[model samples]
Target: MLDYRLFKQIDDCFASGHADKARRLLMEVQSRSIALRDEMNMLHIRLKTLEDALQLARNLFNRDGFYWLKTGDVTQGPFCPRCYEDEGALIRLERTGSKLHCPYCHASFIGSARAAGGGAHHAHILPFV
Candidate 1:
């Protein structure tokens, strides 16, 4: 079976802006899971789910306090990145005129700081593969 601890670690890495590290860790877990004689199928499924979440993170357009999923050549959201990183949520903000609203936390904002992501401080994630 897939351990909840792995998911927690993945969440930690993502919350700290370590998508690459989370992906590496997921790969390592997947490799180790190959040796398990039972519960292998279920574990594989869970690993795949975790990987998908991180992949979503990678594709996110980091905005001021949220992230947008740029998919199909169109930007999909002004989602709360904090919610996504914390709980793997894709909480979409409701657009009202020039302001966007997050129902989860009830925050209001306009525009994006998407370009701000490039200069974010890197986390010191341990090497894993």
Candidate 2:
């Protein structure tokens, strides 16, 4: 916080021909300004991180023991539940045989089977709750 009294003291020092004292006071003001700027920047970063987490929480949904991210009309992911629940990470699960595998946490989940006509297997998409 900037103290108005410091400015008065600095002015008085300069008027009394105390150049060194005035210079030292100016340096103190500069240091305070820099520290204030750093604190503000850190607060901005924290606020942005919190906003991102809130957005993700708003879009994230769970179904059949799996997590999914739904955005607008486009839904993406069948993220690993264990990784998300334990570590707060949305690790996308890779399909392998009859399971979905997490490359990051090495966890697995049972996925839907392929269609009879060899079409792609589709998981049931649900709305975010």
Candidate 3:
């Protein structure tokens, strides 16, 4: 978003034998260029963040009361539903006995019996706490 008029002003300064003014204008141009570069880098970072959010939205699903992330043929999580619903975060649940716990929100869920057996119902929940 640099103004092209600055370059013309620099050219006019040089034509009018205002060498000091031309040098100052050149420095201004350099400063503007650096600012533009930094702004572009920030925009790229924002774009990457938005893309990652889109991908997560496309892949995330709910089974029973818990959240799961699926990519390709692989399924990834038994995330905390309360955390995801309230904060848009994919906080992984920690299993203990027949219960799953969310460390972030201190929420607990009743995990499936098949969870201990490494079955497909791993971390699948029946109720919330």
Candidate 4:
């Protein structure tokens, strides 16, 4: 299958409108399915999903800072990046009143769009040089 560099090459090929080459590279990965572990096989499937999402450029970090996945005409979100990347898990964030919380790590925030620095409008301290 393709490694990170080859995947990047595929990205470059697609960027240059070389669909044939990109598809070919994707096929190489699919063709090597038998040699890949179950996790790898699953990852390839997920990668394909991500590839389409990226192509659409619809996957975005919502106002609350959680990654939202767009599906067709609908958008789903509040995904925790910490869980997704670290544990290979797609854990959704919980909206509790004014805060979006990640249950996995207990990390909570009001998000940049909503917070605007979360009440720190004036500086009481300066850099001591």
Per-residue lDDT tens digits for candidate 2, residues 3-118, read 87999999999999999999999999999999999999999999999999999999998765677788897677778777788999898888888777789877655556332223
The candidate maximizing lDDT is: 3
Give the TM-score of each candidate.
Answer: 0.48, 0.81, 0.79, 0.38
Question: What are the RMSDs of all candidates, in order?
Answer: 21.7, 6.8, 3.9, 16.4
- Compared with the true structure, what per-residue lDDT tens digits does model 3 show for residues 1-129? 688899999999999999999999899899999999999999999999999999998999877667888889877767888889999999988887878888888777775523222545534334543
Give residue 33's error in model 2 in angstroms: 0.9
Better of 2 and 4 by TM-score: 2
lDDT of 4 by residue, 8-108 (tens): 98899999999999999888877665556776879999999999767645455433344566666666655676666577556777877755677776666
Scored by CA lDDT, what does every candidate get?
A: 0.67, 0.78, 0.80, 0.62
lDDT of 1 by residue, 1-129 (tens): 557688789889999999999998898778667756456777889999999878886787665555778776677766765567777788987766756666785556555333333433222212223
Error of 2 at 35 (Å): 0.8
Once fitted onto the true fold, the runs of candidate 2 whose alpha carbons sit more than 4 angstroms away are 113-129
Tell how far residue 79 is off in model 1, in angstroms: 0.7
Worst 10 residues of 2 by lDDT: 113-122
Q: Which 10 consecutive positions of candidate 4 have the poorest summed lDDT?
A: 119-128
Ranking by TM-score: 2, 3, 1, 4
**Superposition error at 23 for model 2 (Å):** 0.7
